[model samples]
Target: MTFHDREEELSALTTAFETPDHEFYVVYGRRRVGKTELLKEFCRGYPHIYFLAAQEAEERQREKFVEHVADYFGDRVPRIDGWDDAFEYLGEKVVDEDVVIAIDEFPYLVAENDSLPSYLQSFVDEQVRGTESMLILCGSSISTMESEVLGHESPLYGRRTGQLDVQPFSFREAREVIQYDTEDAIRSYAVTGGTPMYLTLFDYTETLAENVQSKILSPTSVLYNEPEFLLRTELRNPARYMSILESIALGHTTPNEISGATGIDSGPLSKYLRKLQQLRLIDREVPVTASAKKSKRSKYSVADAFLRFWFRYVEPNRSSIEEASKIVYENTIGPDLPNHVAATFEDVCQEAIWNGIRHGMFDQYSEVGRWWYGEHEIDVVGLSPTDDRILFTECKWTAEPVGIGLVEKLRAKTKHVRWGPESREERFALFSKSGFSDGLEQEVDDSWTFVDLEDLEQMLSAGR
Candidate 1:
């Protein structure tokens, strides 16, 4: 697949190349998030040596690195006895010329030899600094990368000149990559969750149900066991993490609820939750109007849309998938997928609103998130604490036009949100899949901004 969006990352690398000195960059993200692809794109025209570290013994990895360095120099070099000798050779060869040496999956090397970071630190301080060489260390293990490479106590703590935590694409970028109509694109993104590899696995030419059945629900599909594979690779005990994730997926959002459902003590569950949050697999959220940061009413939810969908549908119906039965897709997933997509659509709308704010299309806000009070909830709320202004927004994914009722309800809920003083300025924004009703169109004024699917598409395209 063609590279879609990484302009910022590429620009960063381009700036790094202009320094005319040594550059040490650390790039890390989860698997299949395009870390290697980003590095390869940056290294295209440069004289670079790219080495992918494998899960092998230290001796074997060092030998492989020796071969890569020899190939880059196009000469017979002496065998490397260890990492020190390897880095020394690289530093000597690239001293006079601008060259890049990127080691992908650096964690694999560290797994084999725990002192690889120390060796790298020593080499960078002793030989590579003040030279015209660039070194990029990339990895996929988020926990390991944080604790081993970028941690405060690590030997290579302050050696990196630049670092990037490459994340999955945003909703707008995902739409561009998928090339589907707004509604279908939203549905596809709900399952793919902005992951480039997952988006590429889907075929836009096919219907959503057909694609889901073939590319996701089927036993032979690449994404069938994708979440499982990721969790297993990242966690020492995958089963416990699975239980916690499943609990969250099933709507047990609080620590007490999750612990009750998973039969794990809150103490141990908190540790697991922290690890999951660190991995970007789950997120903790409090009410947007909460006074305290650590509110007791905080909730936990799966951070990745794809993982949420998989845990909600696929993992629970694994027996049907293993039996190769179509009923699971038709009866279980097909019936409820629209509701799932609708929920994800709210997220997409919020993202689009934020993008608009970034592009100067909307007024700046101090805080933006969902707001809830008692039984009433508002989908999107952008509050300006200093300016005493609040934007109350609602997102609808239905085919029927959103009438004035939603706007009225949103106004009613706004009264409950105690953000600023009583004289706070208020605005209303409504986003709908279908166009708004005639009554709503007539109600549009300076304070009300109605956005239909077409309007959203324009906003997304303009922001891009």
Candidate 2:
């Protein structure tokens, strides 16, 4: 709950601050992933001046910036009209030690004045760059930050000493935020994502269904309009973005399908998708070894669980939210969530299995992912990149026992799919919630592994 897994980034930032010379750093990420929180936490005990940029006229923003500088300096300070004068005054005011200046939502500041970057570059080159002060620029829009500020052609391109793109908390870190079973934790993660704002809404003590109803189903809630806020900030056309997001939520992943479903031209859709991917709202994936730029088999998905939930349920139920109607919202969202959560649970199970493999707990797989060819889809597939060894697995979220019949079905589904050189040497695995049938468990040969929710839970607990 308290800054999990950010020690490395924080240490780097600390080093930048402790250096004898000036340090300029850029911190960017998708919205609500705690970029500002991390900076504020790091600012503790330091002589720091923090100012957030508001979407306002240039003159008003300058006044706001001047007021913050005056407050940080303590008492009635000089009146300044522009950033250049305020920065110059700070240079003349400070005598000894280091000063930390953080500007949150720096992109918004740049938008207010297109020449601000050049002005800052000139100021740093002429004055601020020679001092021991540390200047940090923070923004939530990755594309704008990277292009307008950090891009090679930008005025401040090489002026910074460090750059940090802080991603969401990992699944391991997320588990500590709540105490749910393996499957339930994954379900929560998939829906809430690793976003601190969304994760804070989850009450681990309650059932998943209860949490959903309490956090999301209500009329006045923090997250009810989250998707809208994020979309409107990053995009000019919220309707077009919603269409693409809804299409992905409804199980369309390819560009062709998304364009076809949304009626947006594929050429223009690419821009929207790229922006969303930069914000971490969606993800574009290719086969593990595929080329980074050109991979025909690449697919896109709504990577954020809460975004997916909103697209699948809340967006479709817009009328309900507007009309303050609960009957339609609950009845529609209730039954569908389990199936959705169950599929996501399998993805979490696979992620857990990969973590085990990484730590040398499992020697079977060197690579793991979902495999599909035509209509044949394997929920979980692990293949050894070295020896070409392969493992096929099926994950069941039901309470009923997983009988040998399920295994037979897996075998049948995989009949046309060959594994390495010898099919006989291939391994089989079953992951279940209620676990395998007793007789069926006895029937499996030594070439298979049977793991249930309890096993996964124990592994996670031990790892923690």
Candidate 3:
């Protein structure tokens, strides 16, 4: 698959390299989020040495590192028993030149050698006054990367000139890569959700069900066991995290609710949720108008769309699921996939609206998210108290066209939202999958925006 939508990240790295000084950059993100790929793309055509670290003994890792360095330089390297000697020799060879030395999976090196940061700190200190070399340390372990290298208490603190936290693509950027129609794009985005690697596994020609069966439902497919593999690789207690994730996937959103579903004690549940949030595997949702620290009604949900789908449709039915079988997908998955995809439709609707605001297509808002208080729930809310403006959107993902009744239902809930003063200006909008009724548009106020999937796609795909 072709690389897509990282102009900002690539531009940042290029800017650091163009400077005539020593530069240290740390690039990190979730697993398979294109950290390595982005780094490689940035390194193209540069005099660079790239070494991928693995879970191995310190001595073996150092040996492999020296070998890669030698292969790049095409010169005989002296014996380097420790990191200090290794870096010293490296500094000696690449003296005062523009070269990039990127160490991928840097957390693995830190894991093997706890003092690896100290050694690198020394290297960076020397490079500061000595060479124009750029050192890029990249990793997938969000916790380890943040705590070990980027944390203030670490030896390498303040050593980095710049950092890149490579993130997943947005729905608009992902649509360019997936190359599917609006309907299937939503389905594919719900499954892949901006993760570049997973998005590439799908073919635009195939239907959503066909793609799901071959790429996800099949036991032999790469993504079939992806969530489990990632959990085991990243966490010490995969089973506990799995239970919490499965609970959230099953629609148990609150701490008490997750505890009730998993039978895990509520006291320890916060730690797991915090850890999952740090890992970017789950999201803690608070009302759009409320602060996270103050919101008592904050809820947890599986942050990764693919993982949510896996936990929802794949994990529960694993016992009865057959490899590469259509029966399971046809009978069970197909029935529920629409509802599953609907949840993401609400998210993208918010995203599209927010992106529109960002691009000056709409009024700027300070926040955009779901706002819920008991029985009153708004699917999408854009609030800017500074501007004394709030926008509410009613998003429907049903097969039939939406009518004025749904519009009226959304208006009824607006009075319950306790935001801004009574004099604040308000806006109403509707986003539908199957479009809206013709008469319904005329019935509603002319100021209101009624957007269907096609318009939403155009707005998003046109660089939202």
Candidate 4:
């Protein structure tokens, strides 16, 4: 509903606006990811004119632009008929003072007028090259924006000075917006992935069930149709995209698995994957060290939590899901969600370790991530980027105490992973939701840092 984050983006835009010369900047993101809001907020106080390109023909668009420029110019606003004239008039208005003129949904304009970018670029080269104004081209269609505006061969290529690929709000910022330690907060996060527009539906005071029933399950509510809206905006064939996304959500990560599950061939599926990846709705990742740029090792997953939730529960049971009542949906989501949450919890732990090393919480380490060799996979890997020192950790989300045998197994697994012969200084670490076994705890006098969930909470709380 309101801007709760993006201080950094706003600051960057502010600096750009205050800069000299004819500044051409582009801001793009997936649809409904708040690209327009960021631009609007950044352009609020300045002498600015905002024009959104629509799906109209070039002539109609030109007329609308003329009307908008006319409005800004008041009685003296020129009766310009073409985009070139409109931009020229805009250049005239801000000849002396620097101004921000934003054309939101710029791709639509380009679609309507294929030569729009070329025309603007030509206008800038001829009349506005030396002017003191900023032209922002903002769009939600990521692929089209990149190809049409920022591509190397694009007509507008090498013209724009800055570009912002606006992303969904991070988990930390989302937490700030809804500061609750309850399950509802986690569920809301898992459902929305910090998209401000979607997260606003979550009432901080209400239970997760209440929020879901009121906002998501209700036929008249905004969330009930949210998936369709997003899917429609991002893809041409919503059914195919929905199938691919649901397969990934259901744990079919590999191309073959997704294809098998969705009954789509891998050849056609790759295109969908690319589109989804470009939209930032899903991620295609390797095992952190997989060599091939695109191979079978690459696994696909829904990158946004909200999209993941939709695919996992809502999309799969669209035909008969609501008939089962809110209680059934809640229970179904409840059981499998903690496992997903656990994976994110491990990610948080990895970040904590990195943050710790940055703030002197640990003496040494370089890299950290999921590490594996053959079938043995370790959750945390801390390798000294500066030195040969390496640390391996197994993060667990259980109440049971991690015993010495688990450490021994991890040590054995490490043997397969290469760390050079001189990597004798390697140490082992464990992060647990519960705590360590007493025998293992006594053994780890100073050789390791046995961190429990409470300890991590304390460390995070101290902001060290």
Candidate 5:
């Protein structure tokens, strides 16, 4: 499990360390997203002290913190009575030297003592400021990190030198971790999403079905109840959140539809939706061409691919899993898994396309996302509002080569998209898992870009 990507984040942290001024950085993301690992990697070869806070009483946590500080200093440090005392000890030890003091799972400490942030603010202002010490506060609770640490009313609002919201790896990064062919790598990513922890658990040598059965369907597996564990950790009402997530996974995307399926009122449902969105468990999507603020047609979908798979397959078949029924994996999961992967493959292709856009491989676009109108849906749309140009894309995740008929179908849908005037210049791109047909390759000219597995592998392998 070597660190694969995160060059940008590592670079930013290295820059923070190089600066002479004291730095207070807030880093937070969901569990197993590598926040702590990222900090540990940054602290390597440097004079740093990392303290992981546990879910314990305030006094107990302070004693542990004091012990860690003492160990770092190699001396008999006095017992810390409070956070202020702890930070004071830290400030004295790293006043002149470039030292990193990272507190992992910081929200656990905040939960024990509500006034921890204010104490931290005082410590930053009176002790750490103007020094070469860098204090990195890390947490997994997105809501707590947002409302308590970086919120407008937070005590340490203006005190932080920088903030890093670490996210899961993209498909390209995931490929580096899961060593497999391009098609199989895509399938593995569909199951693990971009989460490094889950990706590492997958045995690439085994068949996808075997891996799914052993690593996911088994009751003893680490990922068996992973989504439940995360929900319980972050939310007070885990059952309610689970119901909402299950509804979305079952294709109940609209508010009314979800409410109908879950038997929850729309008013309370909105709050649950907002909370889940804040946690990054689900996302609300409007049409790519529509204004986000004014768009009335919004669909909710599970944001994490692992959670999507869990809710769709595992959660519903918990009894079968407990009973060790092979039929559950072979009949139910095995049959529908490819279709699920197909949907996720579209997302991966969109990400690959976005990477191309960032590298100036595609025309400049103001926005890019999935677009739909009535019964027509375009997989990917890159819109350059100023230039009156739009790139409509279709992603096919099938074994067979995509033919010209699919391109024709995509072209027919493009005419219905109303972004600008009818004279708007249009570009078309197609991504296929198994390359394209000869007819498609010959029919398309310079305006059309056909991206297959080989092209995608090349784009992903550029920096490898």
Candidate 6:
């Protein structure tokens, strides 16, 4: 719940405030990504009027907004009839002192009134252009916010002095809040991703199983119903969307595969996948060695880690959990949780590798992602712009230390990866749950990096 890691966003807002003229900032992201929290944090040391808009009549929202304006300016609540009068009154208040007027859920206002952004464009140009006061438009609806506020055709597009896309916290930032031990913490991140709101729901003192049993599996808990509720709230066809997500989480990645699994036609399935992609609920991935636009091997996966966890464990076994909650955890999810977490370990290692690049531990990477050609698959591939360095990693979430044989097998996969020239230096990284054996340690060289669970933790900690 406490604010951590948004210094970059905070700094951007602060810099905007320090600029000489009036500033209009478009701040946006998906719901529960902490846009509101970041905005509130930036407004902490300044005189500001924070107005949260809602789904209501334009008159109701205007009335509420004017009241917020009135409270900030120490004036009586006026019976404002229109946005023109509201802007005029607000303009008068911002003339002498700098006061930020942040409209949270700005898209909601546009939803109620289509011409609201046009009205804002005129207001900023005529009313607040030369004033020191700032205006921030924040929204949870990513598509609505971008198209309405930041799109080229939008009236308010060129008017914005700055924009901030508030993203979910990184795994490192998530770890700061989710203070479990290393293994459990990774499991927790696999469940929650990096969303601030979701991270707060976890209690570090409790074991992973305890949290899953109580926070997610229990019928009354928020997480138990989260993915279903979120889809219903965000998408018009919730049942169909749920089916598609469950299919992807279950390992049906391609369009035809998903269609066969869900019985949805590929034509309509594409639209659903596009919508989910736009909402950041699903991500489309091509191999690291291939161009995404032209690749026929593109695969779609659930982007939100928690949604993946929900669809995989909760959605499938809902009936079993309803029948017996305690038995369900021990019998169903508990046994398979390790495998679930292991699936996510490759991503965690890639994150650490990127962090390593930032801190000079790893060579520079122009692109880092999974690469697969036919039956050959490389877990993590980091390509360099320099053409001199290419890194391939194999992640093993096993109980025992990785031996030289496994490393050599990973080395064998590198020959199939066709990116740089054959002479290009290919480096290998092995990430393991337990560690590397003494025999494998002898094989470590300039081209090889061994990352155990603790070493991975420390690598992530570098940025934290």
Arranged by TM-score, best first: 3, 1, 5, 6, 4, 2
Q: What 10-residue stretch in candidate 1 is worst by lDDT?
A: 289-298
Give the per-residue lDDT digits (tens) of candidate 4, residues 1-464: 68767888898888887777778889998777788888888888788889988888888888887777668767455677677777777666667667678889988888777778888887667765788778888998777788888999888898888989888875545667765662345446776676778788778788776776677766678877787787776567788888888889889988989999989987998888888887787887655434447645577778887777777777766656557647656677667767766665676577668767776777667556666555777888776646667777787766488888887888788776676466456777788766877777776557677887667655454452
Q: Which has the better lDDT: candidate 2, or candidate 3? A: 3
Which pairs clash inside model 5?
none
The parts of candidate 3 lying over 4 Å away from their true place are: none
User: What TM-score, over all chains together, does every model reach?
Assistant: 0.97, 0.89, 0.97, 0.89, 0.96, 0.96
Give the whole-model CA lDDT for all candidates, comma-separated.
Answer: 0.86, 0.79, 0.87, 0.75, 0.88, 0.87
Task: Note each model's CA RMSD in angstroms.
Answer: 1.5, 3.0, 1.4, 2.9, 1.5, 1.6
Q: Cα miss at 357, model 1 (Å)?
A: 1.8
Kindly list the per-residue Cα lDDT of model 6 for residues 44-84, writing each as its tens digit.
98999999999899999999999998988788998887988
Task: Summing lDDT over every window of 10 consecutive residues in candidate 5, give the lowest-scoring window.
Answer: 455-464
Instruction: Summarize candidate 1's per-residue lDDT along 1-464 as a digit string, tens digits.
Output: 66778999999987897787888999999888989889999999788999999989889889889889888888696777888888888778877767889999999999888989998998789877988778899999988889898999999998889999999998887777786888788888898898889988888899878888899888889999999889976988799999899989878988999999999998999899999999999989877878556677778989888998999998988998778647788788878887888878888888878877888778888788887776888889998888998999999888799997887788778888888899999988899998878776677578888888888887777745
Best prediction by lDDT: 5
Which pairs of residues clash in candidate 3, taking residues 3 or more apart in a chain or in different chains? none
lDDT for model 5 comes to 0.88
Q: Please provide, for model 3 over 1-464, each residue's C-alpha lDDT reduced to its tens digit, 9 standing for 90 to 100.
A: 56777989999988888888888999999888998889888899588999999999999999999998888878775688799999888887778457999999999998888998998888888754457788999999888899999999999999899998888888877877877778888888998778899998887788888898889888889998999888865788799999889889889999999999999898898888898998899999999888889889999989888999999889988866764368888888888888889899998898888778877767888888999999789999998878899998888999999988898898899899998999988898899999988788788776589888878976785553
Q: TM-score of model 3 relative to the true fold?
A: 0.97
Would you list the clashing residue pairs of candidate 4? 191-306, 366-383, 366-384, 366-385
Candidate 5 residue runs with Cα over 4 Å from true position: 462-464
Q: Model 2, residue 166: displacement in angstroms?
A: 2.2
